[model samples]
Target: MHRKALLTLLKEHHPVTADEKAMTQATIEFVEANPACFERTLLIGHITASALIVSPDRQQVVLIHHRKLDRWLQPGGHADGDPDSRAVAFREAEEETGLTSLKLVSPAILDVDIHPIPARGDVPEHLHYDIRFLFEADPTEPFKLNEEVKDVQWVALNTITTRTNSVSVLRMVQKIN
Candidate 1:
């Protein structure tokens, strides 16, 4: 969507303070004006989020091995006009993983990472600003993998860094302590 139109939609749906609104608007403008800038620029430019579904004892986390990317990642996607990015994160996690009984904690903003989309054979390059958020789920809840993921498993925290996850995902795990 165009920057101005997005800004207008955001304002109409999820009103924020003048300063916050301006900042969000500016980011939308910058992203629309220079799509390439997304690859390098980090921060709040693109407000996306991920759900870090930590185990009850905080010893492990749920992760999805994305089919297309072939890398493990926390479940999440674009906010898509949702005012609460945390909600977006949780929703995506549930939808993608088929675990509906998860619960978010006190809404901790874990960390943010910007990375380029892998070069699909025919797709243009894009970028994602992954705003990670911490959440918790009952350890016994049954999980069903969805097609968006090639595999889904709960991995120990120590094993996370050893996997083929992005460096950003590792960094998010580091912040858990």
Candidate 2:
């Protein structure tokens, strides 16, 4: 989406708080002032969401072993112009994991995690502002892994912390417990 269009949408949907407005404005100005920055980035500067999908038993969490990153990550992706981050998180989670019976919790789990994208082939580094949500699903929900993922599993939360998962994923587990 164009930077101006995104800003206008944000203004209309985002909480009309001073800080939020200022941040939105600043982001717009940055993009406008530095087109090169936008070109270099993989994902445009906009809101995005992800989900930490937990089982009904709450003992395990759905995770994807990302082939590109080679680490366990929650199912999520860009908002794709969706103003509602929670809906974005849910959509991506369902699409990537193929779990349709998931339920999003009210007072949606929220967090901001920024990470640098590794240099891939000729693409340079970029960053993602991951807004995460917590969701619940039946313990036996069927899963069909997408090609974007190397593997998917319902891993015990404790096991995730022991492995080399991203700090954001680890922090998510900590927050839930």
Residue by residue across 1-177, what tens digits does model 1's lDDT show? 333433343334321235434544554555467533323333324556689888878898888888877778889876665546667888889987788778887554565555667645655565665556788887688888888888778889988777645766776676666
Global fold similarity of model 1 (TM-score): 0.71
Q: Which residue ranges in model 2 land beyond 4 Å of their true spot?
A: 1-46
lDDT of 2 by residue, 60-90 (tens): 8888887778877898887655556677788
**How displaced is residue 41 in candidate 1, in Å?**
18
Candidate 1, residue 164: Cα displacement in angstroms equals 3.1
For model 1, the run of ten residues with the poorest summed lDDT = 35-44
Which lDDT values do the candidates have, in the order given?
A: 0.67, 0.67
Model 1 stretches with alpha carbons more than 4 Å out: 1-46, 119-123
What TM-score, computed on C-alpha atoms, does each candidate reach?
A: 0.71, 0.72
Residue pairs whose backbone atoms clash in candidate 2: none
TM-score leader: 2
